[model samples]
Target chain A: MLRLNNIHAFYGHVHALRGVSLEVPKGKIISLLGGNGAGKSSTLNIISRLIQPKEGSYELEGTSMLRKSAGEMVKHGVIQCPENRRVFPLLTVEENLKIGAYIRKDKNIKSDMEKVFTYFPRLQERLQQKAGTLSGGEQQMLAIGRSLMGKPKLLLLDEPSLGIAPILVREIFKIIKEINDEGTAILLVEQNAHMAMEISDYSYILENGRVALEGNSKDLKDNDEVRKLYLGA
Target chain B: MQIIVSGLIFGCIYGLAALGLVLIYKTTDLVNFAQGEMAMVTTFVSFTFLSQFEMGYTTSFLLALLFAAVFGAIVHQGIMKRLQSAPPLNQLVVTLGLFMVFNGLAGLIWGHKPAGYPQAIKGDSIKMGSVFFTPNEIFVMGITLTLMLIFFVIFRYTKVGLAMRASAQDIKASQLMGIKVTNVFTATWAVGAILGGVAGMMTAPITFLDTHMMFDVLIMAFAAAVLGGFLSLPGAVVGGLIIGVFENLIAFYLSPELKLVYTFLLIIIVLYIRPQGIFGGTQSVKKV
Candidate 1:
């Protein structure tokens, strides 16, 4: 559903993503494993059109995303739940969800919101509370819930496990699997190798802005080098 | 006693005036330098309608408010939206162009001669022991306070108001969720123009209905905004009251000419110390 071929991204003078290439097939979880500053996030960001690709090509469902605006990507159902859980701090949980379906004029937003609440019943309880006050895990849930509100075909999740409790991390992984099972494709970037492999269909290991290894998530998890570097075996 | 009464009365007007800037800032993160002129322009629209059409003053005033709102929404969408992602300084430049354009347009359309608006309230004053307030002044204060309260309720309880607030806190996040960010900006500007229109209509009765009146109080109102910290609704009111009292006290007790200068000095000192007004919120910083 999403493809990136030789995509390079730069943050000012620093080369962040160097010719990263990948294809995420529809209705599967594709985990991108990399250390800090390995351009895993940048690769997902380019595909979501959050940041521009300095070189190479990024396509969403066969259409080139090189010149697409962030708003356009949102319209095409390419939603990014950016790292750090960038929820609208002042907005109520309900308002944040309402904003997610911002581009779609579809009248089914109300029912879609109900579906989101089913995934995150906690969010429903705090509908009036400001998003800023939510606990780290709750905020993560809100971010993911918000992306789902967009009715996205391909959701880019950048480190869903970051800053959350370990128990919640497992819960979040299960939710990710449930979401993928519901037919949406996912390109997930993570440093949590064990949890990622447990859920992902395919995986890619990135180093210094390039993809160093690509394989089935189960095969990569079994590999001694992959386990030692990523899983701390 | 008269001093406090006068302070309370004009403070209401100033608060109404500052509300426009506060609403715009909260939604768009950009300051509208032309806000004062925009209000003045809208007031002139009221003035023209009153004169050209024997439709009378009050009905024409309402029409002007609606027209100004339409004007504001158009400018916000057509002009400000294009420069939204541009640098802060560039956004300020667009407002500057708006300031000059609104000022020149008002002058050309309304002419230099001040039109005398029919008195909104009779020149009657109510005496409460040692203090007295004119009927018009009392009306102005009442209208401002009532509207502010109504506005607060709408913002706190209404869906659209919540959406506007959401857009202010984070545009990108709001956009992702399905909030039409463009319409939010337009709504903010439209509301801003309405507030500005109301303020001008209030001020016109006290001063001669002229474009230049906004020029004089613009700086004072702006100083009130800066002192209260931009984007703060209540802060603007408090700051305006403080400015009204402080400037009046300084001019009356100290020196009349130094009132304007002293008010700005207060703003500079305010900025030097708290930069953000008491109510102005600081965005959360995340270090990855």
Candidate 2:
């Protein structure tokens, strides 16, 4: 449901995204894989309207999103669980979740919160606890759960498994697949290429601010160059 | 006993003013050195309403608060907002600049001479055992307590307060949650200025309204904030009271002229003992 064409982004003199383009179809998990400084996070940031691209045509369905602010993107059902699990450290878990649904005026917030609890039952136990006190794994869970509270149509997850333990990482991946199965389209940025390709239907591997390869996830997994570079097989 | 009673009365004013400083500092991470000057200007506005328009004391007080709110919003939007991306040192320097501007403008408009300002309530001191409480003293303490209660309730129970606290803790995270952080900053300044204005109006009757009326109160307020822990609201109030009572005790038992010196000495001693202030957490140290 989201499309970007010829998007070029810059951070001062450094060009982060150099004529890069990608698409996330409705209800599909699209994995964007790359090494460091490959512009994976910058692409997600542009889609979330956190940082505007100097040159691009970005649209949700057909409406342009280039002019919308980050707050407006949330209202348009584009929720981003940013890198580093940026939960409000001083606020309680419950308060953080409430803030997630900040733009909504509906009465179903309580139910939506319960829905978040179903995805991360541990959060229910730590409802009154401050988010900073949560374990890295739990904080990651809270970040995703918080985004889910927005009832997003398009979810942008930037490195959900960055610092998570292997066991918890597997569980998080399982939950991510389940979330997509329930009908929210996801654009995932990941460094764990094996798990990303295993779960995703389509994949794009980026190198030096450009898309170097794009194909079916299964095909890319079998590709020799992908195996040597990203999979480390 | 009478000295302590009067100390507590003045303590309420200092506490209120300190709360204003702490509020802005907590939310914006900028210490408003101009807080006292802002309060001084607002007091002059109230004086204008009372004398020029011949308004009732209650009307003038409420109108002054309204004026304070607008003035605060203008300061934030017109000046502080532009400095958001600047370094913390630069932002602090701008507030110091604002201190001079407000003081200069108030002097130009109201003149430097101190003038008589009326009390909220006019009556004899009510006697309760050995301690005597003037109606104005009672009025100041009552208003301070009520405002404190209202502020606590809003911070703990309301969505707007939640937004403010969230924005204060993490601006980027708050923005991701769809909060308009800029609006939160504006609201914080408005409330902070209102608190300052309240302290100014309460003190004017006793000190007499002048361009520099808030000078002593501002210093004590700063001491109160530092003693309470810069990050803690309740600490500011408690610190103000302690400073207030202690200053009075020093003045009575020792020398009146050396009260300011004694108060700062006490603050330095307290900081040496507990650098975070009584209520401040270790998180404040992490920022440095």
> Candidates' lDDT values, in order?
0.83, 0.93
Show where candidate 1 strays beyond 4 Å. A1-27, A33-78, A92-129, A149-154, A165-167, A181-185, A204-215, A223-233, B1-3, B121-135, B245-256, B261-278, B281-288
lDDT of 1 at B268: 81
**Model 2, A1-233: lDDT tens per residue?**
89999999998989999988889999999999999999999998888787889997999999999989989999988899989999989989998898898889999999999998898999999999999999999999999999998999989999999999999999999999999999999999999999999999999999888999999999999999999999999
- Model 1: per-residue lDDT, tens digit, B42-104? 888887788777777678878998988998998898899999989989999989899998888
When summed lDDT is taken over every stretch of 10 residues in candidate 1 chain B, the lowest stretch is B279-288
Task: Estimate the TM-score for candidate 1.
Answer: 0.79
Best by TM-score: 2
Worst 10 residues of 1 chain A by lDDT: A41-50
